[model samples]
Target: MDKILINVLKEVQDNDGYISEKAMKNISVKYNVPLAKLYGVATFYAMFKIEKQGEHIIEICGSPSCMLNNGQKIEDFLEKELKIEVGKTTKNKKFSLYKTSCIGCCDEAPAMLMDGKPYTNLTIEKIKKILKKY
Candidate 1:
């Protein structure tokens, strides 16, 4: 039941982009789960975001391998460009920056996932161009 609960929370996040208080109440009533228990589950997992996200989700690889290959520089550049610290959504809700561990692109090192699409071998110039598209 615990595992299934996680799956259901994931479904809500997928469809709604984030878990809302109203949705949590609906889940609690529909699943016979306590609202507190549901909130605990939602907050326990980093993958479960309660607050709404920006239009573009940028997850930069923060693995050691990536860091050794200019990942930190890329992360810094992104923060500067976006003018918001990691884990924060921009004021306009256009972009959200986050640091995530290995995305299995060590060989490609210094990579990022923009809206779930892998963008590898990044450079300041490349990122600038990429951001322009969004």
Candidate 2:
């Protein structure tokens, strides 16, 4: 990581893995980077979490291609099985669900990413197995 990013990570670590607006502003000023640029970087990558994530981050691809298949079904299954809505963390804080645009693997429609690892061509059974691994 860059010095600036290391500093940012330290700051986030101090605040329970969440970067507050004030901290971001301070970083922008200290690093001489534009606030918009910092925010853009934070939002551009799925790995740079803005909010506090659970132990596991489950990202479902909901692009048109994925949706045309069984994306919705998979999403519904996750929500129902996890007992949490999209963008929400599980009650046990073990998982957080997010809907994302195409993860660049449309060939694997109805795919999901768990903590940055892509799992494609998912069925309920496969999803269950994947979750068990977590």
Candidate 3:
């Protein structure tokens, strides 16, 4: 059941970019899993987004290596440029900002994932250019 739940949730997220409350209820009824339990499971995993997301997901690494390499500064730059804070989606739904513990790019330190593509050794200028492309 756990494996099934994981697959079901993944399918929902892949299709909608998030798990809506209506979807959760449907899953709960179909799988005979309690709604509260489903919510708890979804909220417990960082990979699960229960709310609506934007067209693009921007995930920045905030691990020790990334922080040492000015990841915070990059996050600040994005917040200012996008006019949205972390964990928030752009008003136009074009982008969503997130800070992740790591993105397996510690070798690159200040690395980021844009729409699942990796960008390493970021600078404010580079961020600006990247944003332009999105």
Ranking by lDDT: 1, 3, 2
Candidate 3 TM-score, true structure as reference: 0.90
TM-score for candidate 2, residues paired by index: 0.69
Pairs in clash, predicted candidate 3: none
Worst 10 residues of 1 by lDDT: 43-52
Local error of candidate 3 at residue 56 (angstroms) = 1.1
Each model's lDDT comes to 0.94, 0.83, 0.93
Ranking by TM-score: 3, 1, 2
TM-scores for every candidate against the unseen true structure? 0.87, 0.69, 0.90
Best by TM-score: 3
By lDDT, the best candidate is: 1
| Candidate 2 lDDT, 72-110, residue by residue in tens | 999999999999999888888899999999998899788
> Where is model 2 more than 4 Å wrong at Cα?
1-16, 20-50
Clashing pairs in 2: none
- Give the least accurate 10-residue stretch of model 3, judged by summed lDDT: 100-109
- lDDT, candidate 1, at 73: 95
Put down candidate 1 lDDT per residue, 1-134, tens digits, no spaces. Answer: 77988999999999999999999999999999999999999998989988889999999999998999999999999999999999899999999998999999999989999999999999999999999999
lDDT of 3 by residue, 25-129 (tens): 999999999999899889888899998999899999989999999999999999999999999999999999998888888998799999999999999999999
